[model samples]
Target: MTRFSANLGFLWTDRPLPDAIRAAKAAGFDAVECHWPYDTPASEVKRALVETGLPMLGLNTVRGDVGAGQMGLSALPGRRDDAVSAIEQAVSYADETGTKAVHVMAGISEGAEAEAIFIENLSVACDLAMRRRLTILIEPLNAFDAPGYFLRCTQQAKSLIEHVNAPNLKLMFDCYHVGRTEVDVPTTLNKMMPVIGHVQFAAVPDRGPPDHGDVDYRPIFSQIAGLGWDQPLGAEYKPGGDTDASLGWMVKFR
Candidate 1:
């Protein structure tokens, strides 16, 4: 069976975090993921998870100072302390909520110095995550959607993971961003399977539900399954309308 994870960060925007978790459970998600749940108490999130009997596949570290235009903290130069603090916070929440992984966001930064900071931060994150037996994921966002984002391609993510050389370090492969940044999704997926820790998807160009997009997810999903990827495929997309009403595309997978 192809398991799916509802991404609360995009879906069910109208509801509270706990309610969204319940909605995702009702909508047939095998698990759930979120952008940032720090605003909501971990106990509340954990209560929802326990009530629904659903596992949180992953969650993101806080996007440092969104008002100040910080996409992430990990890659920013001279922000190692901030980056580590974010990781520590994420791990604490994940540990409390039974989440399996945390995606350490690479804030908008460029050059070798930025990359070095990211590696150092990730190394620290991996050490911290290991205590909880949790994985650390780094994703490559498309420039169009997140201009100046440090990580921009599968190769870059892979290289960083290799450089970090942490057992817990891995990649969060978002198909929407991948489609926006690279051609031939299947080829890229195949190339990236080894390092991929989590996989997310949305319609290309519009970032909507996965049913109607330039990228065909049926074959892509098949390719993922063929590659022995058993983790839940994250449904991280903008619901064009009611979150529950926009779930028609999930039937085929269920």
Candidate 2:
């Protein structure tokens, strides 16, 4: 069977962290992931895992000045130290919590200089992540969501990974974004899976569960199982109603 990993950050926004874990357990999730354990500190993160017995599959690293247009200055020529420091913090946090992967937020300004900067910073992050045994993943946001932001597709992400040539550096293949931008899902998935370290999904336009929107998760998940992807498929979508109410559909399939 294809296993499912619930994203606690989206699933239980209205509830407490402990309650979210219990809900996932009752909903029949095998594992879970989160965006970042911001409100829930490291000790609380550990406690939630212990109390719910839910293994954390993955989480994200912090992006410096995300709101201040300074997202991902790591690759820029002069800001390598800042990037390295950011990566170290995320790595240490991952180590303490038993998570395997972290999202390298590729936030950047719009211009000719952005690409060069991203490449430089990502290369350094990869080197550091390799030492930490961490699979540092880069996610491509759809242009609609991030107009000036760099990295808007799987092919672009794959190129960066190949150029970096580090096994620890990989792509975060988010389906919801892909669904709107790409013509075919499975075909694109097959082409990109080689460098893909993580995946995220929401219904195409609405960012809801599979059934609520046009994307049929059953078929996609079936293909995922056929592909032998044993890693967790992150359900990082907003709920149409109360978070738990929208998840009954997920419980049936998971």
Candidate 3:
């Protein structure tokens, strides 16, 4: 059976984190994930998780100073210390909340120096995450949604993972971004499965619910299962209507 994770970051924005979690459980989701829950008290989030018996799949490191247009710190030059601090903070949060993984953002950076900085920062992150038995994931965002973002392609992410050379480092293969940034999503997914730690989905172009996307996820789900991936597929889409109403596609999977 294909399990689904409701990404609380996109869904249930109108409610509190704990309420969102409860909603996911009531909505028949197998698990939950989020973008950043740092603002919420850890004790409260933990209580919700315990109450619902749902695990938080993953969360991202802070997008460094979002108001300043800084997306992430990991690849920014002269921000190596800041990057490591962010990773450490995320790992600590994961440890407290029982989140299984952390996606280290690379920010809006480029060039060889940025790549090198990313590798160095990722190595440090992997080390910290490994100690907590948490997987460290790197996701490739599409340029359209995240222009100037340091990581924008799975191939680039793969190469960075290779360079970092950490067992705990893995890819967060977001099918939506793949559909937007690259061709042949199925082939790319098949090629990258071995290194994938998590998977997320949303509609291409509009970032809406998967049921209305250019990519047909039915066969894509089969392909993932064919590769023996047993984790829940994250629904990281913006609701076209009510978040609850947008979950009609989930009926087939359930």
Candidate 4:
């Protein structure tokens, strides 16, 4: 059966993180994930998870200085110290919340120097997460949505994972980004499934619900299931109106 996870980062933004977890549970989601939850204490988040009995699939490392347009720190040259700090903080938080993975965001930058910095930081992240038996995920944000983001394609992410050679490091294959950048979601997914730690989806052009988009997800979901991926697919779409109203698409999966 195809299960789904509500990404609290986009869904239920009207409520608190803990409340959102309960909402996901109430909505019949199998799991939940988030972007950044540092603002909410780990204990409180854990309490909600415990109450709801839904696993926290993953969370991202802090995006350094949003005010400065810095989306992440891991790939920024000369910011190794900050990147390491962000990784440690994310790992600690994930540990406290019983989360399964950490998406190490590669901030805006490009070049051999930036790649080297990202690899160095990822090594550190993988080591820290391995201690907790947690997976470290690296996502490829499309150029349109995240111009200059160091890791921008599955091939690039695959090379990094192979170069790092860490068992704990994996890829976060988001369908929307893949559709925008690579243009062939199913083939890319099949080729990259070996290293995929997580998967997410949204409408291709608007990033809205997956039910209606440039890319039809029915066959894609079927393909993922056919490939033996039993884990819940993360729903990371923006709800144009009330989140509850946007949930009509979820009924098909259920």
lDDT of 3 by residue, 60-157 (tens): 99998988998889999999999999999899999999999999999999999998899889988998898899999999989888999999899999
Best by the lDDT measure: 4
Off by over 4 Å in 4: none
Please give, for residues 61-85, the per-residue lDDT of candidate 2 as tens digits.
Answer: 6667767765454544566677667
Query: Model 2 segments beyond 4 Å from truth?
Result: 16-18, 66-79, 110-112
How far does residue 75 in candidate 3 sit from its true spot (Å)? Answer: 0.2
In model 3, the worst 10-residue window by lDDT is 245-254
What's each prediction's clash count?
1, 2, 0, 0
After superposing candidate 3, which stretches have Cα over 4 Å from the reference? none
Range of the 10 consecutive residues with the lowest summed lDDT in candidate 1: 245-254
Q: Rate the local accuracy (lDDT) of all candidates.
A: 0.92, 0.76, 0.92, 0.95
In model 4, pairs of residues that clash are none
Residue 137's lDDT within candidate 3 is 97
Q: Would you list the rank order by TM-score, best first?
A: 4, 1, 3, 2
Assess every candidate by TM-score.
Answer: 0.98, 0.89, 0.98, 0.99
lDDT by residue for model 4 (1-254), tens: 78999999999999999999999999899999999999999999999999999999999999999998888999999999999999999999999999999999999999999999999999999999999999999999999989888888999999999999999999999999999999999999999999999999999889999988799999999999999899999999999889988998887755
RMSD of each: 0.9, 2.3, 0.9, 0.7
- How high a TM-score does candidate 4 get? 0.99
